[model samples]
Structure formats: C-alpha cells, structure tokens
Target: MHPITTVHYLALSAALLLIGTVGVLTRRNIVIILMSIELILNAVNINLITFSRIWHNMDGQIFAIFVITDAVAEAAVGLGILIALFRNKETVLADEIDLLKW
Candidate 1:
C-alpha cells in the first residue's frame, strides 16, 4: 500500500470543511450551526497538523493549539447564548430567535 501523503490529508480536510460549510448554510437549528462551526475549526486543525508533519516544524502544531483554544472559547460563548435564547424564546431554531426585530 502506498504511504499516506500530504495530498491525502489535504483532501480529507477539504471534504470536512465542505461538509461543515454546508451544514452551517443549510441547517435551521442554531445548535447544529454551532456544531458545524466547530467542525470547520477541526478541519483547520487537521490541516495545521498535517502541514506540521510534512514540514517537520512545530509552528503548525502550535497554531493548531491556538485554534483549539479558540474553538473552546467559541463553543462556550455560543452555548451560553443558545441557553439564554432557549430560556427566552424556548426554541433553538435560528430563524425563530429574532431578538433584534422591532
């Protein structure tokens, strides 16, 4: 069997990102959208680690760590908003949470 290559990793990452983007765009549920966002971030992390391995450098790994940290923070804040919206509107659907409407 041929060994895995950077191209293989890149292809997987691209697929993941496409899935995540589609989910975010097509889903009506806020939670699903948030999960999709995380999926996108994870795809990015995979790319970072893949390049790090290919280049034999630590920078990509370090950048992946930062991306992970940002993902965590985003999840926390997003869930908090979701919870608050649920309490007020009792629905997780993005279209129904319209708090900005007059």
Candidate 2:
C-alpha cells in the first residue's frame, strides 16, 4: 500500500464529478439534475480541503470556502427557478419544462 494520500481524495473527487456529470446528462428530473450539480460542487470542496490539509496551504481552504458560497447561491437560485417552473407547469421534469423545443 502506498499509504492513503491527497491523491486518494483527488480520485474520489474525480469519481464524484464524473457521476454528477453523467447524472446531469442522463436524468430527466430537474431536481435530480440540480442535486447532481451540488454533488459536483461538494466533490470540489473535498478536493480543496484535502489539498489544504496535505500541503499546509491556507489558500486551498479559502478556495473551498468560496466554492461553498457558490454552491449555496446555486442552490438558492436553482431551487427558486424550479419552484417557479413547478408553479407554472405543475411538473419538475426537465423534459416537461421545455418551452422552446417543439
């Protein structure tokens, strides 16, 4: 064993990001897509924090903090949009929300 390291964290993060990307690309449910995006952001934070701990760099933590802020904002705005769409259409499915593609 090469001893668990920051690379392990990075690999996990990459796997999460890949899963999120696939979910976003393949899912028809709007809520699930949004959740996958959140997962991707969370994976990024994990990588940042892991690097910060491994390298003893404060900047990585700062970047992770900023990523958290962005994730929060994305959640707020995305959910707001989802709610508005749901109110208007009564469905949260991405396929049903399309207004321009006939």
Candidate 3:
C-alpha cells in the first residue's frame, strides 16, 4: 500500500468539512448542529496537524492544541445552553426554541 500523504489528509479533511456543513445547514436539532460544529473543528485540527508534519515545525501542532482547547470550551458552554433551553422549552429543535424572537 502507498504511504499516506498530505493529499490524503487533505481529502479526508475536505470530506469532513462537507459533511459538517451539510449537517449544520440541513438539521434542525440544536444538538446535531453542535455536533456538526465539532466535526468542522476536528477537520481544522487534522489540516493543522498534517501541515505541521509536512513542515517539520511545532507551530501547527501548537495551534492545533489551542483549537482543541477552544473546541472543548465551546462544547461545554453549548451543552450548558442547550440543557437550559430544553428545560425551559421542552424541545431541542432549532425552529421550536425561538427565545430570541420578539
């Protein structure tokens, strides 16, 4: 088998990005949208790590670590908000939880 290359990594990242975008755009569930956002973040991490490997540098890895941290924080906060919304509205659907609408 051919050794894995940056091109392969890029293809994988592209696929993830596509799927995440579709998920976010088409799904109405708030939880699904959050998951799709995480997928997009993961795709970014893959690209950063792949480039770091190609360049033989630590910068990409460092940035990837930061991205991971950010993703974690975002997930925590998002889930907290989702839980609150569910408790108040009794629904997780994006269209149903229109708290912002006046």
RMSD of 3: 1.4
TM-score of 2: 0.90
Q: How much is 64 displaced in model 1, in angstroms? A: 0.4
lDDT of 1 by residue, 6-98 (tens): 899999999999999999999999989999999999999999999999889999999999999999999999999889878878998888866
C-alpha local distance difference test of each model:
0.94, 0.91, 0.94
Per-residue alpha-carbon lDDT of candidate 3 for residues 41-86, written as tens digits (9 for 90 to 100): 9999999999999999999999999999999999999999989988
Candidate 2 lDDT over 8-92, as tens digits, reads 8899999999999999999999889999998899899988899889889899899999999999999899999989888988998
Q: What ranges in model 2 sit over 4 Å off? A: none
Clashes of each: 0, 0, 0
Q: State the lDDT at 70 in candidate 2.
A: 94
